[model samples]
Target: MAAPLSPIVALVRAADPDRFLATLFAPAAQREALFALTGFNHELARAREAASNPMAALIRLQWWRDAVEEARDGRPPRRHEVAEPLHAAIRAGLLDAADLLAMADAREAETAEEGIPSAGAFTAYLRGTAGGWSVAAGRALGVRGEALALLQRLGAAYGLGGVLRGVGRLAARGRCLLPADALAGAGLSMEAVIADPRAAAPLMRAMAEEGAARLAEARAEARRMLPRSAIAAALPAVLAAGDLRRAGDPLVVPGPRGLAARASVIMAGLRGRV
Candidate 1:
């Protein structure tokens, strides 16, 4: 009989269905480890949303950091859904502590009260968190060198698309993820974008276009540099590409769920393009 899904896997499926679906395409031997890593990422990314205050969020982040340190030192992780599986993945050589810790540090940027400082800063944040995770996933799957670099670019594109898709939800929580520079260039402010996203639709559309370009370039590079086995690690890019294609308005949200999204990912996976 197949082993039952772990709590971390369940949480990932619930919180980030796209990534969870992507994990299903991974080799069976690596699927659980990927789920564990992605689940840990979900927990950190959403820490602010779950906390009562900034202090609480910081505490949660610190807890994960400490957990990673313990796992690195060959200690059993604390008995929590994410920590246990994460520890196992680490022990199994499916993940490393430095990448996980860097991801955690990147997530702290999410709690910034003033929002991301600029477009460049937002991109850097995505690189450290999402791109860093992608690199770790690639390494776990035995990809290296140039392929890892391609995966980082793919991850950054995917992360940008994700941020665009989540604009509505983030704004509802009083967070403006649009770059300050981008907003200013459009004669807008963070407050203006948050209060009325329509005012910034053009700017967001442009950003989506840039992300789509990055995705295309990364896909081409992956085809040349990465083997078929490494494709699963970049599967999220398929969904991101789809969202970028459908991005029309800043306020409209990007992802199209149900059969269409699943089919897109499957097709991309079969073609080894993601």
Candidate 2:
């Protein structure tokens, strides 16, 4: 018999795509279970950036870590919701508890780190979190080797895109994720960019340039390993990058309303319409 979906996964499955596409798009059976995993991830992120007490956040993170261990040990967790997806994934050999623990550990580390340091350090943190996330996605998709490589590339690029989009929000919590030296090297400053997204026209443009470059790199790597049929799987990340570029294009004030319409046409073409 197929193992039951975890309550956490069920929570993730219940998320509306428009509300949380990041956690959706899995097979129906795994939907809720995946959702729960993602929900826990989101909770960690929110805890890092939210205004609640630091002590409270630390307590919650500890609770999550302990719960994961319990689930891994084959014991039914006290909080069934958190235990379910984790237990299911473990039984299926879909994920290693160590990977999940690494993620929780990283979140715990963040509560004390305060500010992001050098670009190297930031990238390490980014990769750990982003890689950890893709590991989960990899488990859900049951991919390995080359297919896994594509997913990893897609996840990393997509995660970076999310970080950029979430910069303003992250900053509100007094956290600065922008690699200050890297930005300065690019002749930019977070304060200036944040002060006036328009005033930092060059900076915004530079960001787009960097983002496009990263997307291109990801696309190239993905194309090498992703089969033609897998293009559909790859589309969302490309579409997301396109959205970012289009949003930064000054000429497209309302930002290319036609892009989606055109995308639909292209998708249809790719699917073999005359």
Q: Which candidate is the best by lDDT?
A: 1
TM per model?
0.94, 0.70
lDDT string for model 1 (101-166, tens) is 988998877777777878788888888877887888888888988888888888888888777777
Off by over 4 Å in 1: 1-3, 253-256
Backbone clashes in each candidate structure, one number apiece?
A: 0, 10
Q: Give the per-residue lDDT digits (tens) of candidate 2, residues 1-274.
A: 9897554544554542311343333455555545555666766666655636667778877777777787688877464565565666666665567767776766654565444546776555655565566656555555566775555555555555555555544444444456667667766566644554443345445665776777677767765665443332344464446545643422223322255644543563264211
Per-residue lDDT value at 226 in model 2: 56
Best prediction by TM-score: 1
Q: Alpha carbon lDDT of residue 187, candidate 1? A: 97
